[model samples]
Target chain A: MVKPETLHAVLNAKTVSVVGASSNPDKTGYQVLKNILDAGYQGRIYPINLKAESILDINCYPSLLDVPEDLDLVVIVVPAAAVPEVMQQAADKNARGAVIISGGFREIGNVELENEVMGIANAHDIAVIGPNCQGINYTPNKLCACWPLLTKRGGMAVIAQSGTIGATMGGWAEDEEIGFSALLALGNKSGVGEIELLDYFASDEETKVIALNIEGVKDGRAFIKTAKSALSKKPVVVLKPGRTRKGAEAAQSHTKSIAGSDKVFEAVCKQTGLIRAEGICEFYDYSKILSMLDAPLGRRMLVITSSGGSGILAADTAEDLGIELKQLSTDIKDRLKEILPNQCVVSNPLDLTGDATANRYMQALDVAITSEVIDCILVIFGDPVHKASDVVRDISSRTDKPIVVAFLGGGDVEKEEVLLMHQAGIPAFPTPERAVRAIGALLKKKNY
Target chain B: MHKLIGKALADEYHLNEAEAWELFSDYGIPTPQHQLARSVEEALDAAKRIGYPVVMKIVSRNILHKSDAGGVEVNIMDDEGLSEAYHAIIENVLAYKSDAVIDGILVCEMLKGGLECIIGMTQDASFGPTLMFGLGGIFVEVLEDVSFRVLPLSKEDALSMIYEIKASSLLQGARGQVARDVDAMAELMLKVAIMIEDNPEIKELDINPCFVFEAGGGIMPVDARVML
Candidate 1:
């Protein structure tokens, strides 16, 4: 294991040195420096460049070794040929962590230089993230240590092998208002892999859910073991692409050879208790819901929709997604009848019918949550959006039962309602299927 | 397993199907009443001792696919019939594989009408030993109806793998036919798993057409291939 202090310094470092810090805005070095400053990182920043005396008004050192103070973390944006020397110097100076955003080496059919860097990092116990990738966005200290972007502080943590994919998830989470505690781009995994980062997040107080998107791993057994341990602490939802990926071509044994990529990974995921999502929409939606609420105790779902068509659609989707549409007791159904529209009829889906108000939605939420029959609630509104902020606020502040929404309306007010629901920490979907899918994800998590 | 593998490797036989039966029997895989005879006279004597209506197959290092190579003969009722089958199998295999070195003959009681099942094991690069359970037939690959599971499996995993295939209903007694012994099959799977779990050298194992009789009638392995 890498030193705990080194990982601590890497994650919560107070002083950073951006190696090969460029003055030009077009280069990644300049952007990384600019992002750190823009993100309002309170730590000291030391930009190292051979020529530049200052970058973004911060005084620059000519070399990492030339920096007068001990460094916590170093971000290397130098050329590939120069990375080995830079890593050696960082190791010599006892730097805690280094994020090498430089490209080349293994991706370009050369691994000697990468191996050299790994040797030095291991000898010195420095936690290195990447040498051929993007960077990391740690919001706890506003450490925008990679590409310049808008990252927020919350529960979900995104860890990916691709920098672009990491950035894409970061941007998606930000767009969806899904707060994240950290966004780490695991480039090449030369020195550090997902298991370490998962270990970090497993105990991270800021992180409640982990959204992992990995194509493959160098050590699958280790990955499974670490993921299993992490699942015991917090939910680890994964999206391993390349499902059609076959095994090594030499299939001398038919039984082993026929073990397709999808089947193996599916079984591994099932065995290790990781929630493997289907698509991007499912990825973030499930991450958000799992982060905010505990998995429901059962598959029983109480879906309340304004339109009967949507109610029926949700009922069908609920069944397909493995969520049981619970039949409300007569007393609860009668109480719902008294509170709901007089023309309404109470059933499993519990249609509120057209012209239902946001007030009715909130009342139905209260009734179902109070009843012990249902494990979760799915609120779907078809049209005529009203002030849903109060409804979402009540759901968030009231009973601890998990709630998801499917706002199928299209208008300015409806968009505002969806946005409000997101802001209030309730996962609101654009369709009933997505909402049911989120609940279904919750159901799957319960199996663990 | 090491002892068996050690002896197979010493003999320079990549897979000794006859040796595989003993290993299988030691691990709870039942085999029919059988004996190995190195000559025609010994083959007839063993057949007589076992009772007539027996099966004989040419056990040779050169023959891998027995039926396709004309190395097997069944339903021999007397010494004359056994004597005839013995020379015919040797001649047929000699013509099929001119350089084939004979390793005596395997004589066993001919099984009655029963269901056929296939249980196999192979080493996976990632997950180590994995087991495949399916109905025995030539259509295993053609129909792609087999169910596989990685080893170190629980009883539930074994049973689930058995029930996962399309032929599970057939094993459960389709039409008015008697049901095949599922617990027996599950035990066989678990036994194979434990065997492979200890011996990594057994790279691939195939026991095709294991005649499974009615419920609790017990199953018997007809042929096996253990590749190291």
Candidate 2:
């Protein structure tokens, strides 16, 4: 077992070498080399290419052995057929780490390629990342070795088995304006899998929420044991594909691995307190919420919404997700009734109607935040009087309790409101269902 | 000394089908309705009165594994089959337990259709009584799809045990088969829990092939044995 601190050091290495470095910007080798340089890593950059003299104005060596000094890390962005020789040279040169960023190995569903890659890496005692991968990114170290261009930074760390999924998640995070601590695309997982990555993230100070997109796990018992220990320190969210029989078969073909019975996985999840998401959207939704907001102290939920339709939807989604919509105390209910119209329901949802101003929204939030009956508040605001971002800013200034927001309508208001809410440490979703479901996830994480 | 061993542990060891069934009934476990006969003539008469086709097994004080010794016969559709099966069972008993007293034959009404499942209880030294549920019949050994819960189990605990087994989907209507009576299965588990709660001397009990029918038909304990 690799130590978490050692893995962190490897991820945050200052100096790195680009093996098979190319001057062609269109190729993956060139793009990754460019990303590493663009991230402004203050370290020596050694470009190792047999044919090239220089790449992007950085001097290129014929091989790692030809380099003048020791390298902290080596990134392999070459063809699959040439990987073994490059890895051998890297090992002989005593490179501290190697990231294999190429395809056509095990993930291509060929046993011959898998065995050959494994034999070479094992013989050299090299801890390789992937033969079919987009590589990895570490925000704190300003290290970016992955190809598909990511720039945002935050507290959520993503560890995905699929390279495409990891890159897509990074892209999604950037598009949603959510920052990431790290993005690791572990393709084929010839050397490292979720078990090692999870143990690595367990002690990583920068990672507040660890999200996993798993296809098939190697060791069920070991994974469960490691996950159980890690989950106590930080929340671990999993979006597992290959749940159905056909999907499991497809996953086996995809990674050359077997997906065990979903029932066993469910039992393990229950025992080890791993939060499982249904799909990609829920995965991002839950991860974003968990990254931004604190875990709910309890399951008691209070909904303060201006739109009656949105309020009803939130309440229904809450019940479906097993979140208890507790009744407010008489004092709290009376206070709400006195401020609201006669038609407004002064119950669990505490509908304030569409006529609510920013002050009214803050007052309702204040009541829910102070009440002994409510554990968390889900505030859904209708079309705002001014900009939706202003309402979000006011709400954040008013409440200390974990607040999740759902903006009702579409426009610049929705986008600006979500961004503002996130900036103020409140997670905002596009729909009431997502907001309620996120609250459910937070409650589960706290209890587990 | 052997007699002393039997006498000292008489209340703590072994029950034939009828005795086990009565004990289970006392604890609210359901079993099929039937009677016992002391002879082949009486067995035939009991089958005639109880209606055919029926199941018959040799009842002897010293013989416990009647099926293994060829003392059990099923689906005796007529008097000829019944008479032949009875004499064969008697001959089997005479050969296996020559010194033991013959305690008649048990004639039971045949239980039909539905999935076969087994519910068992064994008292572990550390865990106390651990209840188990699994697919019954010949393939049971090969397919060890079983789940266990430490007793005494609540209804929720019993349901969780059933859900724990991978083959539980088969019981819950997999591939167009009607879902077995899960409510009845839960009730059966509750009954087993109560039985173990009441009889601390029972060290082990096996109710193999607890025939579970479709919804509304209920479940029946076709065969059972107990060891104290």
Candidate 3:
């Protein structure tokens, strides 16, 4: 069982101490402290520095023991040798958690030093995030321990082994206005790692979906077990790199020749119900779609479009991904034909033609949303259509069925309308194929 | 089973061919009927009992790849053929490894025609035991077309792993060929899973060219190699 209190304190700490606080703006120490202040964290902040009287306009303490009260969390950004001393001082101050954002431990042939830090943290009941990492960001509490302040709070949490990947995903979310609940960078993993973080995020009410970037796992069975339990509550999207590394270089048998770590990791994903993303784009795409909408009841899909070419592209991808583009019954087709234009075709991808209007889409959605045969709907906007976002938002609100929209070929209109659709709680894509692929993530095959 | 594995680990690096077959038979995994012979007379008698068109293989503790070591002879028709093949196998084994201890020869019925497949188990650093399935021969060796599942698999998992490979259409009777026995294949996979689950000491195992007969014809493990 995972004790949530330890991580809870770290994410929602009421009192935090930044050891190695710097007066210089060029150092990481200064940047982290500045980010925490910039995020408008309501918690009491303390900067520990022996040489400086104050950092970031906050009074400094010579050591953690010099603080007047107990600390909930400690942000350690000192040199390698000084980390253990700061940790000891934190233990004396009864700090419950610490995020050690320092290097020169375990990663660069310094095994004994990393082990010493782990021993101290374990003995003192301190849940350390890293000995060498890029810090953390929990937006809900306004705690940005990370260097670059990112505070767009949403439903997705990003946990990455590489700090750059974590920041990249966070930046992408901010650019798209997708937002995130938390962004954790795990480096060296000297203490806490993905397993513990997964357990913590699985129960976090703010995190509806999890995006994990893993290089490798230490314990295979434990990872599978934890991932399985976490998946029971929320969807997990994993992006694992180095898929082509030869784990069978010295294999002696036919079976061993083909058995690689990547293959086993793929098996792990299948067994645990974790969505394995093939690349970084798919990782973010899957995470966004899953967090935004409830999974469709079945694979039966209906594509509505204004252009035949974009509709064809969506249909091809849907077929490749095992999503069925079901044909409409004559009765339903006749109903759609009565409301649509003469050039409109009442088929799957129910093309509304080049002269399509918002009313045409509203009418088409009225018929498709009520059809029992259609499980999901994909609306492709190939040309600029007026007030289309309002039509989609109104239609989507009436039913619980998932609706994905693709805004294309309209240039500025596409950009503005896509943002509006997203604001109205609709998943909007820039291309038809991408919208279909996002739908595919929800209906992946179950190995069990 | 414990005693056999214990003796193999105590004396040699892996289980000899005869011991591996015995282990498979004990677990109810179907293999071609065979017997181990210590001498020429025993080889001739074993061939007579198993019938004509038999295959002979040299069982040695030193040689792991029997085919590569020239320790296998197939297509024996009668007594003269068995006699010549048995002597040739011993000569080849001796040539391959001068200090190898010959543990008799395995004489068995030669499996004729079927869709060739391979089932195997290998230890993963993080995942422990992982099972693999793919088409036999060049398919597994060159194309590297295979699907894997962790140990302790369900019936659905077994069936899916078998069909996950790109060449699975062959098992469904591609181009005018008769469909292979997929049910038996899934059952065989389950049995292998159970066997490995029960015996964690097995570091690796390979059943190459496992013949998948036509529907309702069942399956047979033609060659098995077990490493401790």
Number of the predicted model whose TM-score against the real structure is largest: 3
What ordering of candidates by lDDT runs from best to worst? 3, 1, 2
Can you list the residue pairs that collide in candidate 1? none
Better-scoring candidate (lDDT), 2 or 3: 3
Residue range A1-448, candidate 1, lDDT tens digits: 6655567679898999999889898989999999999988999999999999899999999998898888889899999889889988898778888998998877675688889888888888899987776888889989998874766777889997767667777787777777788888877777667888888888888898999977665555677788889999888889765555342233212111223345666667766778988767788878878887777888888888887888888988888877888789888988888888787768888887888888888888777778888887888888855887678678758766677888886477777887777788888888898888878877766533
Question: Which residues of candidate 2, in runs, are more than 4 Å off?
Answer: A1-6, A109-113, A341-345, A385-400, B1-228
For each model, chain A TM-score? 0.92, 0.93, 0.93
Compute each candidate's TM-score over C-alphas.
0.90, 0.72, 0.94
Estimate, for each residue in B47-144, the C-alpha lDDT of model 3 and write its tens digit: 88999989999888888889988999999999998889888888888888889888899998999888899999999987899999999998899999
TM-score-superior candidate, 1 or 2: 1
**Candidates sorted on DockQ, descending:** 3, 1, 2
Q: Rank the candidates by TM-score, best first.
A: 3, 1, 2
Q: Highest DockQ, which number?
A: 3
lDDT of 3 by residue, A100-201 (tens): 999888777777888888888889889888778899999999999986778788888999877888988888777677789999988876667889989889
Top model by lDDT, which number?
Answer: 3
TM-score of model number 1: 0.90
Which tens-of-lDDT digit does each residue in A1-448 have in candidate 2?
A: 4445546656878668998788888888888889988977778888887888889889999888888876667899888888777777777776656788878776655658667766766765566777687798888887889967787888789998877777777788877788888899888787767888898887788888899998876766577678878898888999888889898889878877666666556545665678899888888888888877777777778888878899889989999988888998898878877776687778878787777777777666656667887778888876653455565566667665677888867467677667766776777788899899888888766632
